[model samples]
Target: MTDDDDLRTRLHRADPAADVPPTAPDRVSRLLEKTMTTTTAAPRRTTALRPTRLITLAAAAVVLIAALGTWFVLRPDNTPGAPVAAPTVTEITAPGIAAKCAEPTADRLTEAADLAFAGTVTTIDGRIVTLEVTNVFRGAPTDVVRVAQTGDISETMMGSGKFEVGRDYLVASSEGSMLTCGYSGEASSPGLAGLYDTAF
Candidate 1:
């Protein structure tokens, strides 16, 4: 052989493949499998809601349902056969009125009248009868209001008697000013007064 070839064979060489651990190929395969499993499971972990978060979502849904139910059931309306409106309670501590009339009910005088009160007739002139307002049930009124009770003013004013001056009466007006049949009647009984305390 050539002298150069012999020199090449004498040179130093390293067996890198021999130094590797025997388990290294198997270990690398196991690590690669673990990495792929972890990566696949990450999508499920991020997408799923935790138990506490699920509970919070359920509670919010329940509260929303309750609130919606309340609003739907208690809405206001004025149609006939509709539920009698809930009474608007005001300070009844105002002076009680003593009037001479009879039989006025909350139901008979449906939800039409805007104002109701027990008052004493101060004067009777033409068709107008001035009254001293004693109680305010559904509206804001001054101490005195003028009303017209024609034909038999006493029929709705109080009892069967004529609307004599200085007599007390119960008046309910739907048109705010003009008094008409049925609703405009004499209210005299203390018990009836209490029952008719609500406006339709």
Candidate 2:
């Protein structure tokens, strides 16, 4: 109606709620209501994965370790369960004229002939004569010679007999000079006869 009344109406119309002051209790009540609503709301579902993942990882590790152990145990050897190979026995025959002789020279022949001194007959068997030779040329022990003799003559000598362990005839010779000596009658270029010549 008047100027002052019009100013007052304009101010009230501009902000009617500005005249009202907010109380502390009203602000606190709003905050409490907001907190209650937030707390009551359904919580987002969280994945229960860490425990399961750890279990799965542990299982995989166990499986890997077990597989490796099994593989190692089952590994095969190059020659599995085979008997140990025996040493190769190489039969080395003696060398010289004894090898050229048709008849096999006895071991005794080498013992009897290899020495400078003559040997005595220790034992005589059919086609086999054992002699004990002394005064060995090369400090060789008294070796026994087993000669092969028949028809008033000695045949090819074979080898020396082992009359006693560690004791042998100094030399052995085959009669008729057809003596062949060797580990197993193996022939050599310079045979036992050559060896005899060198020794005597």
Candidate 3:
């Protein structure tokens, strides 16, 4: 036989055409058409948020609640229609302070003090005396001056008596407040120099 026939016989011996599935003419045409066809896909849409954003939103809510609570607890008497509390410090209401014997008069105080002035007691914070100087008859002073004292007017007593805030008084001071033995009293009283005309 010829070389072509010999090759065909060897190929048929390796694998036969009857082993392959036969394709119908209509199925072959449908497969070819589907492979060549072009189709458009619908665009995707989403409103879902990321996990980090959700956590941040929750934390902000917690902080806002905590701040509101703190303001409610710590705010000073801000509620409407509430009575205002007294601003003055509480005075020691022990039995009336005994009359200090011969509370010093003006001439004695003038002769005794290096720096004397007539001023209003703006505040007495513990042992520190804050005065609003109305008239500086002796010694250089500004409109306001602070003098140090050795005693607490509320709990303790001095020879000059307790200096009440908001009243006018004559002060006899040296380096510090040496308010003893007729050196300090009312500004308009006989205890001060300029306010009182008569000699002691």
Candidate 4:
């Protein structure tokens, strides 16, 4: 016998279902037709779901876009009135030299001074002196005041004759210039409060 014939004989002898009968041709054809129908139906079902999924996603996108548009239209500006502006800064310069001061009179203070207030010195930085106004004596109301010191201390001012932090002062100014000839002095200086009271 040939080698191929010998191999076929061995396979047949070793086959577990060698005695089982073959399936009928009609039954095999029916099984093949059922399998093809199921496979084709699966693809149709998948294709039908694609449109539904796309429509759902599109509807969600539309809702999101509408919500964002509404929020943009209705958002609060949070500004009630005029927008806030920067703090008003009143600038004044200290006298550089001492001058002969006439006796401080209430009438002179009232006539010459356009601004006067009682304030406590809050800081003395470099050549700048900042004071927090505690009371308004003869001028427009202000919360804070800054004075530019010119290194030279005027003996005309009371108590150390210069601006010092934590000391209360009664200050008078004429046209943005600080008056130093006893018109402006420490609050506790003799007759200073009385002078302001009489002037205002």
Candidate 5:
């Protein structure tokens, strides 16, 4: 047989039941058509997400603005309000005593140091008398006096009658120094310096 005939026989024998029919020109045409279709068709489109992205950004910006506004409104003022009133320094005096007695007995008695108070005489032993002055502006007894005299100073100076307990006395002394009051003798008792320094 000829060479061409022999090659065709071998190809036919390799796949005799195969459905693919050999046609060089037809196969070339089909491949060209497929290439044209692919090239001419539009490209797959990516979804447009700009609108959704813009909305999310706008929401975040609104939240930030709201937070800033709230903070500004709630901020405290640096300058405060008016000052408060100080406690009244009311010096209680003896009933019926003239207001002029508020002054110091003498210039040698130092400045008006007697802290006017209203309270009862706590104790009165011979030569030593303790007055428990209360309702004091500053808490606790502000003054304690040790009166040094020849006779009962409470009755002598206060009056000829007896100095009863709970009877209030508006006392003036040499600088509100605490000493045994209503006594008359040469006994020296330590004066009360700062009685209300800590008691208050």
Candidate 6:
């Protein structure tokens, strides 16, 4: 026999399925179909999961967007408003009488003066003078005091002898009337503080 025929014979003897009967075409076709269905089925299922994962991600994104929108709409405002307080005012009217005065004594001040304080003049509108109370020497605490300047200031008052805006004064009052004749005057008046200290 030729070398090619000899090699074919050797290969055929060594083949593991050489003695097996040949498969029929119809059976082979069924096996091929089954194999195609089994191998391709796993890939089809895997491809379907991609769309499902995409849909899940889309749903999560929508929920996150909705939550953020709600927070923005319902957020609390932090704007500031006015915080200044209105001052409490105490009104006292000074007597307009120009009377013959006697020497002001601490004994008289203690007996007659019911309210005494140190204050700064804030405004003067016609015969009305407004003072912002600084320190209360006697009586209830007050933020402001208004006095009606009905007459000339006593010559005994220190500084200008009259109420002037932005200047501090020591004042004493009884029954809603300002005391004059050295009993109330500028804060820097000599002996005035000593008199107040002795009186109250």
Cα-based TM-score, every candidate: 0.39, 0.21, 0.38, 0.55, 0.26, 0.55
Tell me how far the alpha carbon of residue 92 in candidate 2 is from the true structure, in angstroms, after superposition: 14
Better of 1 and 3 by TM-score: 1
Residue-level lDDT for 22 in candidate 3: 87
* Superposed model 6: Cα runs more than 4 Å off: 1-85, 154-156
Which pairs clash inside model 3?
104-182, 105-191, 106-190, 106-191, 106-192
Query: Model 1 lDDT vs. the true structure?
Result: 0.44
lDDT of 1 by residue, 45-109 (tens): 21112233323323432342344334223422222232223222222211112344345556756
Residues 142-190, model 3: lDDT tens digits: 3455656544333223323566665555555555444544455554333
- Indicate the worst ten consecutive residues by lDDT in candidate 1: 40-49
lDDT of 2 by residue, 1-200 (tens): 69999999898889968878777898889997666433322111111112232233233333423343342233221223422232111111222332343432433434544323223343445545444322233323332334444333212332332222222222332222322333121111124334443434
lDDT of 4 by residue, 1-200 (tens): 68999999999899999878999999999998666433322112122123333333334333423343342233221222311232234667776656677888999999999988765566678989886554555555554679987647567786568887656677898887788777887766677767777887
Which RMSD values do the candidates have, in order?
Answer: 29.8, 42.4, 36.5, 35.1, 42.2, 38.2
Give all candidates' CA lDDT scores.
0.44, 0.33, 0.44, 0.63, 0.32, 0.65
Worst 10 residues of 3 by lDDT: 39-48
Q: Looking at model 6, which ten-residue stretch has the lowest summed lDDT?
A: 75-84
Clashes of each: 3, 38, 5, 0, 10, 0
In model 1, state the lDDT of residue 159.
54
Query: Is 4 or 6 the stronger prediction by lDDT?
Result: 6
Tens digits of lDDT, candidate 5, 1-200: 68999998899889857877677998889997666433322111110112232233233333423343342233221212311132122222222222232311323223333443333343456644444332332222343333333343332233223333333333343233321232111111111112212112
- Candidate 4 residues lying further than 4 Å off, grouped into runs, are 1-87
Indicate whether candidate 3 or candidate 6 has the larger TM-score.
Answer: 6
